[model samples]
Target chain A: MNQILVVDDDRELRTTLVEVLEQEGLQAVMARSADDALERLQQETFDLILLDLVMPGTDGMTAIPLIRRQAPRTRIIVMTAYASVQNAVQSLQQGADDYIVKPFKIDGLMLTVRLNLQKARFCEETEAADLDKIFNGLANGLRRQTLQLLSRQGQMRFMDLVRALEIEDHTKVNFHLKTLREAGFIDQTSDKFYQLTTNGQRAATCLSYICKSLEASAQARPPIVP
Target chain B: MNQILVVDDDRELRTTLVEVLEQEGLQAVMARSADDALERLQQETFDLILLDLVMPGTDGMTAIPLIRRQAPRTRIIVMTAYASVQNAVQSLQQGADDYIVKPFKIDGLMLTVRLNLQKARFCEETEAADLDKIFNGLANGLRRQTLQLLSRQGQMRFMDLVRALEIEDHTKVNFHLKTLREAGFIDQTSDKFYQLTTNGQRAATCLSYICKSLEASAQARPPIVP
Candidate 1:
């Protein structure tokens, strides 16, 4: 179960939030102030923090950097009143990942909590060395294209890739193929066809997202003459 | 020269910012309040707006969506007192692109202004349909790889691309090549060599940035077991 720390001065709100979180199968802990939250941080690790901004003695804003320092990977979500919605944005700039307004509906709060937890898990699972290899593997355009091709075709023979890529330099293609094989993005099947590995498929998905964003950004641009 | 609108109830700060922007060769206009700023926006289009959050009427936060609706492409940079630095982030979330706290150095302010103007120009110059073509041209992995290959090689013959891409089927390569040509990303020389067009080069640069970001994001991911 995911561990969550709720830092709020209001006992009633804190209790309500903790109950809501527990009902959702999360392990929720309460802290009455920023100082209390810091104390808890030293004692245990938390996956996420729901920090109230206006708590007395070491206010939420002041405690953000401190909490971040002590638990660098913990996801902090600031809780602000509706009138201070702008403060939520400020909290984000100060390093909070997301925010919830006071009088928030249970559904919205739970959704935000779940989303951050999912992101936290992804961050935890990703390794620096694995990322380095993934970067080096996809660094070359040919290699990226190879991954994309395999994603689409599922499997392709050496000659098929050669034709699809249209490179006259067979040795150059072979070199890139070897590089990808070493990076674990692709492997030769029993039938001598190239296909994406599980990791390779993940990389391909990331690539697709990148491409779609590129397209979206492009489409989102205002007309040149406008 | 880029047109800039400075909106603030404080006459002294507005005058100073206007002078600074003018010194940097930007055309600066002034508005006394959010209402005044909206009125100016109606009369003339601006490339950028420097807005102050705490005014007598219609605060900056409330004005953001209104200003955005009136001048969708104009970049808004909220100006806040040093104590309300968090409000800057709130401003950003509310639709402002960037922010600067009061008592900021002139150099930093100029830098921010120039950067926003540059971005505004980019948005102004980008057309929706052009982006569509760029997306379509780069949709396929083979097509994107072909662009990358040409980017590295500068120019290549059809057979050269065939060899470099390692594909045995020439027609598939030919089809993609034609598509890229029609999309205005590449062109064939009289000598039968292919090279990226100016737009294609831009697309290549965009692709390079995307790849680097992917690498960076991968590297930035926290360890799964952490």
Candidate 2:
């Protein structure tokens, strides 16, 4: 489970935030002060830290560098009741991933938290050149359709896949299948049944999820009847 | 609610499919044959249709064109037990969005359904040049971060956003903000506070969701220990 550290001086707010984070299926730990947060950070790594800008001692600004030094990969989201241009600028420069004004809606806060964690993970995963291979495999519509077909069927033979894909060019289908196999997204059995590898399954799932979200977003917008 | 019509001669499979679709938060209606499916199309408009290929009467292949003529917008997925290269090609030529081999995993089926719906909706929403505008607005990391910030905070003042963004160059901040506003992603109040427009919020949400899904995919893969 992804762990988050929530640091705030107000006991009530801290408790509420922790509860909400836990409800969202993340492990939440609380710290009453920046000093406490820093101490906790030294003990274990956290995926993210929700830090309050104006704590009692060692304000969020002061603790930013300390937390970065302790867990460089941990993303920080700074919250401030007295939100200002200067503070926002300072926080971002201080290595904070984002800043939220106090009195934020819970839904908005959750979105921020989720997005930051994703951004951090994306950076980590793409730190190498493997992303290039993944992109190459997904570059063509035919290959993507192939992934979609395999994702549904679990495993299939080459001829059936070509038929299901409805594309008549046999050589094109062969080329795309070879590319996917070389990218480590698929494996062909001795009997000639092709199935997605673990990486392929994850990639296909992500692609489907993204497409769904984009559609939902578009639907949520009011239709512009021209 | 998105409504789907499932047509299959196999009563048990149709029931299982309806149950699964309902479980996934969609309204599913069933039909016994291609004739029955066409009747349902005339009675009610559906977002999607799942057609079985090789049914007893008015088989799937014969019904594809009739169904498309009746409801051109409704995306169709053709399912077949004897999936072949010819069947796949014929299905696409007949206007099917995708096809799945019979005996598919329920999870894979759901993914296909979700992706096709998304693809259909995306095409509808992007029928004009609006998509290019949205992409242009999202082209810059700084602009995307700006959207992320606004999405979380609801609104912010000019200088505060600059501070939060941690960029020292005023001209750059001004440029990105102008780009967003012109692209219809944001609005500026008379008081100089900036907030995302409805479209902006939807786009931002979609971006966050996609990023999160991609990260999840990356995490699911075996770690490449460097």
- Against the native complex, each candidate's DockQ, computed on alpha carbons, is 0.04, 0.08
If you assessed candidate 1 against the hidden native complex, which CAPRI class would it receive?
Answer: incorrect
Which ranges of candidate 2 are over 4 A from the true structure?
A: A1-211, A215-226, B1-123, B126-129, B219-226
lDDT accuracy of residue A123 in candidate 2: 54
Candidate 1 C-alpha lDDT tens digits along B165-209: 999999999999999999899998999999999778766655543
| lDDT scores of the candidates, listed in order | 0.74, 0.75
Best by lDDT: 2
Q: Write candidate 2's Cα lDDT for A1-226 as tens digits.
A: 7789999999999999999988888899999999999878666779899999998889999888567645555788889898754466456545465788889999999987887777676755553344345545655667777886787566899899989989798788999998899889999988999999977875565444334434544434543221
Looking at model 1, residue B10 earns an lDDT score of: 91
> Chain B TM-score in candidate 1, rounded to 2 decimals?
0.60
Task: Give TM per candidate.
Answer: 0.41, 0.40
